[model samples]
Target: MPANNLRRIHSLDGLKLVMVLCIVWWHCMPRVVFGYSLPDLGARCCEVFFLVSGFLEGYRHGLNYKFTFEELWLKAKSKLKRIYPEHAFFLVLSILVGVTSGKEWAVLSDSNVISAICNALLIQAWIPSFAMQFNGLSWFLSSLFFCYLLTPLVAYIALKAKRPVGVWHLLVATMACRVLLEAECAKHPDIYSMVNIHENPLVRLLEYSFAYYLALVYRGRLGADTCSKKVSFLWSVVECVAIGFALYCVVEFNGAWPRWMYTLVFSGVVVIVAGERGILSSLLGCKPMRYLSVYQMQIYISHAVFYSLGWALFPTSSVMAHVSLFVLIVIYCFAVNCLKRIRQNKPKPTVTESFYF
Candidate 1:
C-alpha cells in the first residue's frame, strides 16, 4: 500500500494504553493485598508490548523505505533518538534518588555500577545478572534495542520472500526452535539457572520475530487500513473463541501458559480489536485513550523512576499507598511531557544572532 493510503491505526494506541496500564498496575500493586492476590498478567503484558512494537516496525517497513542496510540503520537511529534521551534522563534521576535516599538497594552502589552502565547503554538484557538492575522494568528497553538491531535483517528476509511467510511457517519454525532450546536447557540446567529465563534478549527475540513476520503477512494481505469493519457471523464466532481462549489463559491459568500460547492469544485480540467494529473498538479509539498513547514511553519510563523512589522511600504495604504512588507517577509523566513540548516549541535562534562580533 502507498504511504498516503495508510492511516494511523488508532486502535493500536488504545491497545498500548491497555498493556501499559496493566504493567503499571502490576508494578504498583502489592502481590497480595489484604487477603487477595493480584492476577499474574505482568509478564504477559510485557509480551503484548513487544507484539505491538514488532507489528508497527514491520508495518512501517511495508509502508515506506526499502529493505536496504542504510534505510535500516536510519530507522535504528531514529528509534534511538526517540528513546535514549528519555531513558538517560530517568536513569540519572533514578541514580540520584537512590543515592540521596541512602537506600542500600539503589542503582548507585560500586558493585552495581557495571550494571548501571549496561542499562545506560541499553545492553543490559544480554547479560542475565544485569537485566533487572537499576530500574528493573527498564529491561524491556534493553531487549527491544537488541530487537531493533536485528529488525532490518528480519524485515529484509520477509520482504524478499517469494510469498508471504505463511503464519504456519513462522509458527512451526519458532516453536521448533523454542522446543530445541528448551530441551537443551533441560539437559544443562546450569545454562538456564545462570540466566534470567524470560527477560533474556534471546528469549524475547522470538516474540519480535513472530510479530515481524505476522506484520509482513498482515500488511500484504490486509494492507495498511486496520479500521473496523462489520464481520460475518462465523468470523465473529472465531474472534469470540480466540478472545475467550486468551482470557482463559489469563484467568484460569493465572498467566502460566507457554510463551507461544500467549502470543497466539495476543495476536487474536490485537487483530479483532484493530479491525472489527464494535463497542469495545469504539471505546478504544476514543480521544482519552489516544491522548495517553502519545505519552506512553514517557509514562513507562517515568513510572520506573517513581517506582525506584517509592520502593526506597515509602511503606507500600497498603492499597492506599499503591494508589497514591500511581497517581503521583501519572502526574510526573504529564509534567515531563509538558516540559518537553515547551522545549520543542521554543523559538529558534535568529540568523542575525549568529553574526560574529
Candidate 2:
C-alpha cells in the first residue's frame, strides 16, 4: 500500500499510553498489585513497545524498495535526533541527582564512569553490565536505537517477500530463533545473564524483526479502509479475546510461558487494534486518548528520576505516597512537554540579521 493512502493508526497511540502507565506502575507499585504480577506485566509491556515500534517502522519504510545504505544512515540519524535530547537531559539529571544526594550508590562513582559513557553514547544495552547504569530505563532507548539502525535491512527484507505467507515464514523463523536462544540460556544459566537476555541488542533485534514481518502481514491481509457491521463485530470479538489471553498469560502464567508466546499474543492485539474496525479500537482511537499518548515518551524517561527522588525524600511505604509520586511525575512530564512546545515555537532570527560590520 502507498504510504499516502494509509490512514494513521490512532489506536496505537492509545495503546502506547496504556503500556507506558503499566511500566510506571511496575516501577512504583509492589510486585503483586491486586493479584497481578507487576514484573510479568512490565516485561510484556516492554515487548509491546518494541513490537509497536517495529510495526510503525515497517509500515512507513517497508514498501520503499529503493531504500539504500545512505537512506539507512539518514533514518538512523533521524531517530537519534528524536530520542537523544530527552535521553541526554535525563542522563544529566540523574548525574546531578547522584552528585547532590552524595549517596553511596551514586552513578557518578569512578567505577561507573565507563557505564556513564556507554549511556551517553546510547550503547549501554550492548554491554550487559552498563545496561542498567545511570538511567536504567534508558536501556530501552539504547536497544531501540540499535533496532532503528537496522531498519533498512528489515524493510528491505519485508519488501522482498512476494507473499503474505513469506512474511509469516519470516516471523515464525525469527520467533524460533529467539526461543532457541531462550532455551540455550535456560540450559546454561551461567552463559548469559537474565539482564543480558532482557537487554541484549541482538535479542531485541529479533523481536523487532518479527514485528516488522508482522506489519507486512497486516498490510497484506488485515488492514482495510472499511468494514461491514458483521465484520467489525467479529473483529471486536477477536480483539477482546486477544486482550483476555494476553492478560491471562501475564497473570496466570506468571512468566512461565516462553517470551515469544507473549509476543505472538501481543501481536494479535496490535494487528486488531491497527485495523481500527472494532469497538475497542474506536474507543482507543478517541481524541482524548490520542492526546494523552503524545507525552508517553517523556513520562517513560523521566518517571524513574522522580520515583527515585520521591523514595529518597519520603522513605515511605504508604500507597498514597506512591500515588502522589506518580501524579507528580505526570505533571512534570506535562510541564516538560509544554516547555518543549514553547521552545520549538519560538521565533528565529531573519536572514537579514546575519549581516555583520
Candidate 3:
C-alpha cells in the first residue's frame, strides 16, 4: 500500500492505548499493579507523543524554503487548532471545579496565572497546575510546546548537520547523550533517587528529537517526503530492543534503573511504535480503535480529571470504585463521540461557511 493510503498500525495504536492505560494505572493504582509506588511512566508516554509529533512535524515541515511565509503560518495555525480545544476546555473546567470546591490546590497564583494566560495563548504549556499541586497532563503539553517552539530550529539544525556516518554513529551519539546528559543527575545522589526521576526538559527534547531523526532516516532523507524501507528496518529493530530493555528495567529491575536509562529505552520503543508502518496495529484496526485514537487529546484531557475525581471519591483502596470509574470513563467517551456525530450531521453555523467552509 502507498504510505499515504496506509492507516497507522493498530499495534502502534494498541501500544499507545496500553501506554495510556499504564499511565493511568501508574498514576492511580500506586504499588498494587507494578510493585512500585509510582511508575512515572507518563513521562515515557509523552516521549511517545513527542516522537509522533516530531515525525509528523518533520514530514510536514520539510525543506523550509518550500513553504512561503503565509503557508508556514497557516501550517502552525492548523497544528494549534488541532491541539488547543481539549486543553482549553479542561483548564476552564478545572478552574471552575477548583473555585467552587473552596480548595486552594487548584487555585492560580499570580505568576502562574500569567503562565496560565500564556498557556491559554497556546504559546507554552505553563507550569502545569496553577497551584503546582495538580494538572498532571500539563507536563506533556509543556514539553510539546517546548518542542514546538524549537521545531524551526530543530529543522534548521538537522537539515544542516552532517548525517551520522552510519547506525553506529547514531548509537554512539545516543549513548554519549545518555552518559553526558545524566552526568549531573548521577552526581547528585540525593536527586538520583527514584522519587525525583530526573525530568530535565532539555534532555527530553533531545531524546524525542533523536527518535524524530530516526524517523527521518526511515523516510530516506534528512528532511524529505519519501520513505525508505532500508533505513526503516534499521530504526525498527533498534527501537524494539531499546524499548524492550527499558520495559524490563521498569518491571523486572524493581525500579532500580535511573530515569536517564528509561529515557534511552523509551526513545527506542518510540521508533518501532512510530516507524513500524502500522503492521501489528493493522490487525485490530477497526473503527472503534481508530475512533479511540482520534480522541486521544480529548481522552487525555478528561482522563486525569476523571482519575483524580475517582481517587477523591473512591480512593485507590476501593477496587470496586476504580472499576466503576473506568466504566464511567468509557461511557463518557462514548457520549462525547455520539454528541460529536450529532453535531457533525447538524446544519452549519453560518451560511457563508456552509457554502465555503
Stretches of model 2 off by over 4 angstroms after superposition: 34-39, 100-110, 193-195, 224-231, 316-324, 343-357
In the range 120-200, model 2's lDDT, one tens digit per residue, is 999899888778866789999999889988877877776677676777788888899988887888788787664477788
Model 1, position 38, has a per-residue lDDT of 65
Q: Per-candidate TM vs. native?
A: 0.84, 0.88, 0.70
Task: Please give the clash total of every predicted structure, in order.
Answer: 0, 0, 5
Best lDDT among the predictions, by candidate number: 2
**TM-score, structure 1 vs. true:** 0.84
lDDT of 3 at 5: 33
Candidate closer to the true structure by TM-score (higher is better), 2 or 3: 2
Q: Give lDDT tens digits, candidate 1, residues 1-357.
A: 664465555667777777777787777655687887766767778877777777767665652556677887887887787778777877788778767776454634676888788888998887877777667767888888888888877766655555654554765676567556655765887867654546877777777777777776777777456444654566556656766777778777774555656776787677666554555655666677766666667667777667656665665545555555677677876676566557668443221110100
Report lDDT (CA) for all predictions: 0.68, 0.76, 0.54
Candidate 3: stretches off by over 4 Å: 1-10, 34-39, 59-72, 100-102, 107-115, 118-134, 163-179, 185-201, 221-244, 273-288, 311-324, 335-357
- List all candidate RMSDs to the true structure: 6.3, 6.1, 6.7
Q: Report the C-alpha lDDT of model 3 over 162-220, residue by residue, as the tens digit.
A: 66445335545755775675675668746544312223346556665665566556555
Using TM-score as the yardstick, the better of models 1 and 2 is 2
